[model samples]
Target: MQVFVFDWTAYSENVDKFRENGKMIRLGKKHFNAKTAVDTYKNHAEAWQELERYGFDGVAINEHHGTPFGLGNSPNLMAAALSQLTERIKILVYANLLPIHEPLRLAEEIAMLDCMTGGRFICGVGRGAPREYKIFNVPMSESRGRFNEAFEVMRRAWTEDSFSFDGEFYKFDDVSIWPRPVQEPYPPIWVPLTGSKESIEWAAAHDAAITPGVFPGPMREDTIRYFAECQARYGRKVDPNKISIMVDCYVADSKEQAVDEYGSHLMYLFNTLLRYDQVWQEDVKKKGYYSSTAFEHLRNGAKGTLAEDDTVFNEWSMDTVRAAAENMPLGTADEIVERIIAECDDAGANNVLLVCNRGDIPHDMYLNQIRRIGEEVLPRLQAHNVTFVPHAQFEQAAS
Candidate 1:
């Protein structure tokens, strides 16, 4: 079984006494008054190194925003840092938001990282959240279209010596990019998901890896069912290694303590995170993302928040917030393993990615969970062969 580790590297200095003020917490090294990401990097450096030490085959990173909610919107830059810190473990940026920046430069940056990492890079891309689009002055509606084109352009820019393209969103003539990606044809493209039908279909057509957030909750089952249904309807068979499910995890001696301790962080995720769901703003439409199937306008980013509807957040609505938090298993190692395995089987998923330190899980809790997972749960999962293998490190045995 292949296993991957995911961390938002959530920042905060308090270390104890949970509180978020109904806003995104300033939880990272940089945002929580730490001098820089390098400082926050120190906190996780050992943990990530531990993931590698404990036999996780791949390590994944993601972007988030707002003080206490997220400070790292440039996960790719950090991915480069990880390449130096980790060895043998596959490195992935669960995504680099495509529409927010120039695709060509992004492509080159990824390519450069690939070469530097000796081809250990697993490139994930996406149209990203509407709030981000609003923040960057990019239209939400146009993001998907631009995303599709930008992906194509990146592929070309990475593989071909010279290429050009003309699309509604991006146009380039005489496009010659240097430092082609080390992985022949291109590195694996992990399609970060937002649980949209359109997004699923796109991943299927391209045979890209799919990674979606399954915030611990009652909705976990629904999240699994939806994705499995989409893949099946489209005749897409996701190789377990290529498909991943994300979990906001914190391990505790008992479930109640887990919930009580982690509740505040969960609240922040629910409230502040809701703000990002909206597909608000006239610019998003003007850019060709004019119509969106996304459950947009669930929060405040002020591009014209859409009235709440059932279609967007689905089972993850306001009422279910408590249930969702309740669903995240914060118990003994065995219990967590059982819950994770059951959830994976029910949802037809095999990969379990835990974003540690999220919700400000305590350092001791983090250490215990990591070791427990490594010492107990992981071997069992491997024995069952029920999950993706954390990319294994191989060396030539003496012949």
Candidate 2:
């Protein structure tokens, strides 16, 4: 039951500027303001401080490229900023897009952050969104191979004093990186996967933690179960703590108040800021980018615009969204606690990543929501023994 907070610190204000045009790379220079960009980071730091104060086990930042959905073009940079600003809680980047990065440089930066933070970093990695491939100009067809190779290289780089590696995308000779991570072997490597069998198998073989990113409760449970099946096939035992699930959440004095204050922001987040429309599918398919089994499942019954597929936007009713949210723990503090317990029990997941801010939710209101959860919900959850355990501990023992 170790709980963490996640936010993209998105440039939500710029939604109107790019939503219609559907051009992400162009949106940066034409629409982004330097001051506003700086402010976004500053604001994220400020909000993270509040999360730290609320006693979250960790604060998770996500990476997104060429999109107004998030400003964390470099989640490592955000992790660096948070390293200096907070203490005690882990700083998770969920995650860095491994395919698009130079592996050696990325590995060194992560090592530096881990050492500098005194082992408060959790390295979360992924293949990344389809649009990210188009934006970064990385071949989507090679994404899984690239991610696998990059991860293998980084692991060797972090653990070996001096290493040489030759891989399809990255190569090095007798290279020794300075500032080895403080964590033994390395800090936890969390692989947040949707539906790639290769990715799931890789994570299981490495004993890395796995999470069902942004999937709903039932889907998340199914994914975790699938991961366990993979682990068993590989002769590995599944640890529930390594199976985390994400939920969009807020807590208030009453269910009604929670909905009234948080409903619109949640709706705006799903419908506009986080919308995955037909454009993404067309581009990824056209370019042969890494395909997601999860996305395919989501698109199964779609007739038009995969966007119209079971999204809150397609439902187009607060009642619909609220019903779904309620199932995932979005209501009063008591209700949230109960829902979270039930959801975790069903999924056999011990870690929960909660998203509290999105789509112009006022900073003050978000802080208040955090305060309420911290004071009311968290204390109750303590009975469940929600604690943070590094994935390295599990991997080290298995090794």
lDDT of each candidate versus the true structure = 0.63, 0.72
Inter-residue clash pairs, candidate 2: 140-289
RMSD of candidate 1 to the truth, in angstroms, is 8.4
Listed in order, each prediction's TM-score against the native is: 0.76, 0.86
Residues 222-334, candidate 2: write the lDDT tens digits. Answer: 44555566677677667777777777678877677777887877666766666633245545555555344423332232222222334333523588666866565677787
Determine which window of 10 residues in candidate 1 has minimal summed lDDT: 390-399
> Can you tell me which runs of candidate 1 are displaced by over 4 Å?
14-32, 36-38, 65-67, 212-236, 271-326, 362-364, 387-399
Candidate 1 per-residue C-alpha lDDT over 1-399 given as tens digits, one digit per residue, 9 for 90 to 100: 556777777664433333356433433443345454455667676777888889876788877654444546788778787788877778888788888878999999998889878999989887765667766887565777888898889988977778889999899998888788889888898876544556656776677876643332323333333445445555654356665666555566776666666666665454444433344434344554534544332122112222233223332333354465456655566777777776655444566676655545555656666776777677766554444222111101110
lDDT agreement of model 1 with the native: 0.63
